[model samples]
Target: MPPTVHDRPRDDRGYPVPAITPWEDGRPQFALTDYQRSADCARQRQCSVCDVLMPRGPVWRVVGAAESAAIGAALAAGRPYRNLAPTLEGPGHRACMLYASMVCPYLARPNARRALTAEHPDELTAAVVRGAVRGALGAVVGFADYEFAVTGSRVLFRFVDVIEYLPHDNADAHLAELRAELAGHGGGPARPVG
Candidate 1:
């Protein structure tokens, strides 16, 4: 079975520890990307969640509604969206993506707001904080081939040839169904390729 919130390691604030999240002064900075680890994951073709080597395939990414709409529009127009828009987080296995969607405060709760800290003065953090304040309607999970791009000191993923997109209004229900399916299969990771 995929690990539950309680099953995963927790930070001082009881937040589930994301595999690739950077730690600062013993705290996980959820709003920031760990550039070195992100680069390593990209180079090694690893799942950002489980840190396992993912087979060559379309990986899963969780994005906000704005990005989803942009991608959808780009697809309808028969245009590529990768260069115009890039994701901050790396892709992961399907199970890991679902698990993160189910457990992450920002993804799971629309009312969850990211508190701005003086330490994080970057534009990315500012953007995240603004998004959180406005509230999110839901999350979109997309499967696609991705390439890494370096912008300044940050590493970003530009998704290409997206095969499918799943919009989830209720992450809890979605994850429960996924968990049940995995349980029926004797509890293993679900790998999907384009």
Candidate 2:
């Protein structure tokens, strides 16, 4: 039997959220529990066992004026500060910075470049897997270039690429699934398989 809703994890607050990746059957393999000591997660915490920095706030629900803008506009413009209810500039526009940094083949870190080091030859490279999984995820939703993070062995989502106004096409359904995955409602506490 799967864990009950009570088995779910939470944040600094007492919310019953899911683990990033639950210990399930067949999935990408990652251990999220190791970071318990390092991360500032004690309140409503469960381990991803992989040290994933998931979205701390709300799940992204992208919307646009008529269509999604490009990745550039969304992040820079704040006027839509919930002020512009529906603008073509979608969420991707705002979160592009994160992708340009985290997913880049080059040094993604903004201020400094870490040496091209630690080759995860033995198993799944978290970042690489993240990109792939996110890609498939976007395919399901009809978008691209979403910024993401991992936690509790699952891909906890914080943001989505809404620019290009594409994701908005089926925003409701897609958002629901993505949010479910991030919240650990996607499945069991299964570890990644690699």
Candidate 3:
């Protein structure tokens, strides 16, 4: 049987392991991306979570509330929102995206703050710093045609003609349900990781 998102192997800190998360010194670094895998996923139009090729059509992505609102406004104004902003992660299947949003501590918690470590200084680290500055209330799942752009060693996604956007109110209620479910299974609420 395929493991549910809650059943996936977790790191020492208990974050579920995503297929695209990079490993370093034999440990998964949830904060970093494997650039090669990211590029390959983009090239193959694969889902970041499941690593399966997605059907041709709108690709789904999760973005901060601010970016989502901007994209929504642009779509409403009939303005070209494509390449208006660069996304850190590649697109994925809607189900995979939702599963990720549900399982990921940062995305699930509206007031969640990203922990910045000074040990690794890289493009991703800079991006993390930027995200911390902007602050995130919740996230939005949106679908659109996308093109990949390589900036340094990172693969960024630029959306074209976003068709729909679903804003999550931080999923607080859903998270409570998930926590209860986990507890029923003898697992507890997901622990915060740095």
Candidate 4:
């Protein structure tokens, strides 16, 4: 069985840190991820926000122009999205995506700059998946299109793809509309039922 949160050490805030056999061997902190689960569970990828396995199907990512360009270029070139490293945080469900767009501060933040630059991520990305096994986002073995972000170091990483675009200006309204539609279908927010 996978080690429970109690099995891990805690930070000053009492949040679980990474698992370690001994204090000397462990880092001060580690972000918990589905990969940390035991073999059986690790095979399933959990949504970062919902903590549920991402369902299989078309996953969505909210992207800006820069990201769209990368995806387009990769598709045209028939190449895998290549970059310096994997920053993709797995995937998420559509309901989760809608909820996030409505409430996420990052998405709602004012644009730092009007143009893409090397100093910061030119593209904002988020994932929404459907039909995923065990609702696990990590279950996606491969992606057809390539996405990337240009770094100050000039290195690129295989970024996650943006299946859909959610503009910051109208995200709230869009999410509200989606929420109403979902409600009509008896769907609700992605929060835990309990």
lDDT per residue for candidate 4 within 1-194, as digits (tens), equals: 11233333565667544321113344342322222332222235443344455454434334433443555566557654433445434334455545544443333333322222222333422222221111101111123233334343322224333333334443565555455545655233322111
Which tens-of-lDDT digit does each residue in 1-194 have in candidate 2?
Answer: 12233344533454333333223343321223123232232223322222233233321223222213333244346322122222111122112212222332222222222233323522333233222222211211123223333356323223333322223222233344434545667534322111
- Which runs of model 2 end up more than 4 angstroms from their true locations? 1-34, 37-71, 75-111, 116-155, 160-194
For model 1, residues 1-194, the per-residue Cα lDDT tens digits are 35533454668877676667788998887766688888888888887776778777667777765676666676678766563455568888666776777777667665666655425556444465543542444554555567887666777777776665555655675666566645765134333211
**Model 3 TM-score?**
0.71
Q: Looking at candidate 3, what is the lDDT of residue 141?
A: 48
Off by over 4 Å in 3: 1-15, 75-80, 117-127, 130-137, 172-194
Task: For model 3, name the residue pairs that clash.
Answer: none
Candidate 1 vs candidate 4: the lDDT winner is 1
Local accuracy by lDDT, each model: 0.65, 0.28, 0.62, 0.37
**Superposition error at 102 for model 3 (Å):** 2.1
Rank candidates, lDDT, best first.
1, 3, 4, 2
TM-score comparison, 2 vs 4, better candidate: 4
Models 1 onward score TM values of 0.74, 0.19, 0.71, 0.40
Which scores higher on lDDT, 3 or 4? 3
Worst 10 residues of 1 by lDDT: 185-194
